[model samples]
Target chain A: MEKTIGNKTVNVSEDGYLIDLNEWDKDVATAIAQEEGITLADDHWKVIEYLQNQHKNDVPLTIRSVGKSGVVDIKGFYALFPEGPLKKASRISGIPKPVSCI
Target chain B: MTKNIVILGAGTAGTMMSNHLRRALDKDWKITIIDQRTEHHYQPGYLFVPFGVYGPEDIVKPIEKFIPDGVNLKLGAIDKIYPEKDKVVMVSGEEFDYDILIVATGTDIAPEETEGMMGPHWQKDVFDFYTLEGSSALAKKFRDWEGGKLVINIVEMPIKCPVAPLEFAFLANAFFEQKGMRDKVDIVFATPMSGAFTKPKATEKLDYLLNEKNIEIVPDFNVMAVDGEAKTIMDYGGKEVSYDVLVTVPTNKGSDLMERSRIGDELNYIPTDRATLQTKVKENIFAIGDATNIPASKAGSVAHFEGEVLLENVLNYIQGKDLKEGFDGHANCFIETGHGKALLIDFNYTHEPVSGTFPFPGVGPLNLLKESRMNHMGKMAFKWIYWNMLITGRHLPFVTTKMQEAGKNFD
Candidate 1:
């Protein structure tokens, strides 16, 4: 399924996770953040930036790696993304769902 | 006339009962088991998944492999049950009449029952290690993850494997130490109980372990909500626990089929007579394992013990004899304390886990309420025992279904 996020038409799974990574942009991130009941703060942006950078560099984004990234501490990462930090951060950053998640 | 024995579910209790009944009953009795899925999971192994002790493939096998030749295995969802008529209806519109019915469909983690539990963060930062998929997902999450405040919380009690969360904390401590970053991880154990565990004797030993490991124990915490945005879990009393990553043992409930069949409690667990393992709902119906509302630990060991009691009582009921009120709520648990050491606790309805040796009075190789390498080996050996001896209805030489007080230390 596809939904219009801001000005971009991005593909999403039935569960509302982003399906197409290529279709994601800054506007899409803002839209996802809005849906998740979060306003993108600087700390949130740092996680999204780190996640997008890791995806671009072909690095696997895990909670441990994210904690070790030095961009934010593990607790800070949770505060930034709230409910599911890794999932929401990745979604807002416009990446395909992580393989390890259910 | 052929008498039919219909067993619902093909899990540990159901599978073991099926095997036992097939051997004990004569050829005139036709045995049939109904399950929605074909694969059976070693649920206890799920606790080891996040720590990478066991993989998904190592714990799962075909249900048909354990089932005997004479038993009929039916694959279909349960639609409804008519206890009054001694019949069961499947979702596919198939029906089966039974002279005796045993319900052992078991319980599952219901994450959605908690508010904000299955939100966007689900499978991301907040995860459970109870199910095969959940544990596998957590295994990936734990890999290369520098830890922060790792909160292991139980939403409520009476869950399967009561000792598992404590085991997880111990294993995670070991896991991080192996990664050489044990100092970086702050582990917190938040529970609804007043202490580290339910039984007093076991609680004292476990509390010391937690204190020695520098892991915080937040007891009597009734979780009300998970504020994903704030990254904190709020309790009923307005206390909050923040987490870097949250590992939860969600609320466990009986199979949905139980409620549809009008044979279960509010939680869908069937009402069963404590001693006999027979359903209080009907004379011909019986319930066992995690599916029943018995005051027993919902562990595989308890199920195995119940299987022993059930086999005898079910047979007696079939022959119109007095049912044996022999089940003693026997449960044995192994607490994995990491570093190649573990603890074993054996208890039943009346007794709490105490300090001493197990099975053998003065010559036991296993220690109770104390950490030992022997206990660890015994814990690891149980997987093989479960597949080979326990489910096959083979009697274990040393242990009995009833709790023996000879070896246990009360003073």
Candidate 2:
């Protein structure tokens, strides 16, 4: 489905995740973060940028990788995004949610 | 003039390939499979050990017993593989030059990765069931345990048999109830994922099962360290969950041999072409099962499915023919929900497990993604099928390498 975020219509999944990374923008990320009761800051942007870069390169994102990415530590990432930081930050970054083998 | 085709790790994947290639290839090809261990364990049976459903003797057999008559089973630890020279060196200074190499050295639990996991309380109050030693130790622990705040934690993602932790919680729920100590036991499932499982539909179904069984769920809890003194596991996010007894599925990493050989990723898993099972190192080198970072479940069933694709691709590589992209990451596993019931889930890289009938479609004697006594029977019967048919390179009747989309409920 498509939704308007900051005067722009973007496609997203049923859970409000961006369907296309190409469709994602700073305004979209800020909007998604704001919906999660988070205010985008310099720290959050750094993490988001790290996640987006990894996604673009076809790398799977884990809390472990994010913690080890030299961008931020796990504790700091959690403090910035609060509960379920990995998923929350991922949605804001306009990437797919993390999944493991079933 | 016979060509050498060497296979490393005589576990499920390597053993199966040896049996497969031995039967398929002519007398012109010599197949040599290597392993440090002599015992070939029925790994899936490890889950049943702690519950007293399966004894150690039942799950283990001599590794050589599975090796067919024509294939040579070399028992030795692999030191390193010099892929450029097409040779493998042993720690004992043995060497084998090969025209083709197969890497089936699967993943193993690394409890040491987490701080204090191997500490004073290790295998005493804290346990891991991924190994025969740990499972047997836990069996003894559970035999006399009074039961209070039982915590089962999966430290990270991509562990072997991802559903095993959930099954442990479910079985524990039933185990205590059978012992008439259900009230005394408070079971909590702590995991890194945000739900009962990784997939949406399966997670919903399993989450319902957790609720029905009264098992508490603590989601998105990534372990940072274990405080043995406090009997608590603290996540990186500063969340703490205390436990009376903690059963953790530690971080799983591919064999250390991968790191030594410099042919693997950070986790020591070999990078392979997902569909072709061919490694990035060379055309003659291949990988299967948990050893390869192929985005498939690290379970026996996945290995079984990958075996078919690998066999074809290997033969093609030798004959100078175009390789087939036959592998679709098909994996089918029986999710044991305890108390004479289980759920059978069949899926692949593209498809998630859906509710439907299995092999027989609508007329299925087995169900998919739904619990049934019939499915439980199928799971139990799998033990015989594994030893007699699976590793022997015999195919299951009506089961295909690619997942069947028919009779499934997909929205």
Candidate 3:
């Protein structure tokens, strides 16, 4: 199923991948860890929120650099969001457009 | 048979020229663009990427997406340009012949041009926001960064978007504040210029902001080298400053094709007439944007305005008529100061950035020299305009090709 949140349209699938809103979900967050080949802890979410709020108005959020928020271990986060915060989240959130993920 | 118009480099200038000419020219002329990369990057987004404001995925799209139909997209590195024979050689062992050529080959960061800039600490401790990789790496560094002396240094002038370093400093202050490390971080602005910006009035206002943000400014400091192990940067005058992390804007150079073609100046920039953008070496060739050694800020707005003027001249050249010398180094940039506030500056070759309103003389929702939330929004809004209208060579409603002096205060 696809849902429109704000101006962004997200895709939700059965495997727990939210295509567009992956930045906001914990499962996509964990998937981000596996791609970057790292582990995410509960503390990493704080960094994610900080990054999301910091650039929310200017750009979209993704999985690529979600782990690099400075609050989390960057190498570890790199392991999680290897491709980036936006990409990982986009894959998990099932959002059609990446801009809404921000 | 259709005439071939070859454009070098698929960056902002080349892309704009391709779109503009595609619309203006008839089907008689086949416009072909050559670039090695497949993706078109929103170069301005590089600054925001480091602060986690723009993600890597958001700023990039396939080059083919913006390129209009009927334009031949050549995805290969350009080996050399044989102006004498009117041919461009690609690294893939292919040669393209053109009746008219547009040299939109843009500039790139040459950190290695400096003595020790690209040393062991690059991206780890020393970084630049000019490239996607550098900016994203610095974003990670900015996070968990407990804060110390965050030195923002500019090695030389004539860099793309002259005010970007200052923007980085301003945003860094905001970024640290959001992270609750504002008090711990000592942000410093070091430049080769005498002031915060190139223009005097804008410089005064920006210098004031530097002070307000508690960021120190070191002016006229020509960097000699970077001692990354010692965490210090030495200037030509023997001055030294140590930093926990160094965000440096290294020297920018034109495409290597310029050097290979033996047409570029000392910095690999093409020597061109400032007004007509015609290459000094070749009468049929023209240069725009950072590729030319023009006395203008290497910015997208300059290229945008130049595209309009150059199109007219290119058509004139094709018709064997006198070319129009119409380009006035018009450049307008949105200086992001973070915290939902930014400033707009508009100037040309003759005029400096003055205090006034933009698009309108007296009535403007966007203010110049003075910081405002509207200007910041305007900055954010430009990304869409760039993608949709500008690259497509569509005419913008408010902006024009020439610089307007009506509403600006000269004094």
**Chain A TM-score values for every predicted structure, listed in order:** 0.86, 0.93, 0.38
The candidates' DockQ values read: 0.01, 0.55, 0.01
Show pairs that collide, candidate 1: A64-B145, A64-B146, A82-B228, A84-B121
How would you encode candidate 3's per-residue C-alpha lDDT over A1-102 as one tens digit per residue? 765433445565543445444434555555645554556565555555655564544333322234334565434543444423333434433343232110
Ranking by lDDT: 2, 1, 3
Best by lDDT: 2
Error of 3 at B66 (Å): 0.8
Backbone clashes for every candidate come to 4, 0, 32
How far in Å is the alpha carbon of B348 misplaced in model 1? 0.4
Off by over 4 Å in 2: none
Best by DockQ: 2
On lDDT, who's better, 1 or 2? 2
In model 3, chain B matches the true chain B with a TM-score of 0.98
Q: Write the per-residue lDDT of candidate 2 for residues B1-411, one digit (tens) a residue.
A: 989999999989999999999999999999999999999999999999999999988899999999999898999899999999999999999999999999999999999999999987989999999999999999999999987899999998889999899988888898999999999999999988878987778999999999999999998888989999999999877899999999999999999998999998767889898899999888889999999988888999999999999999999999999999999989898999989999989898888888999898798989999999999999999999999999988998999889999989999
lDDT per residue, candidate 1, A32-77, as tens digits? 8998888997888878878888888765565546866899965677
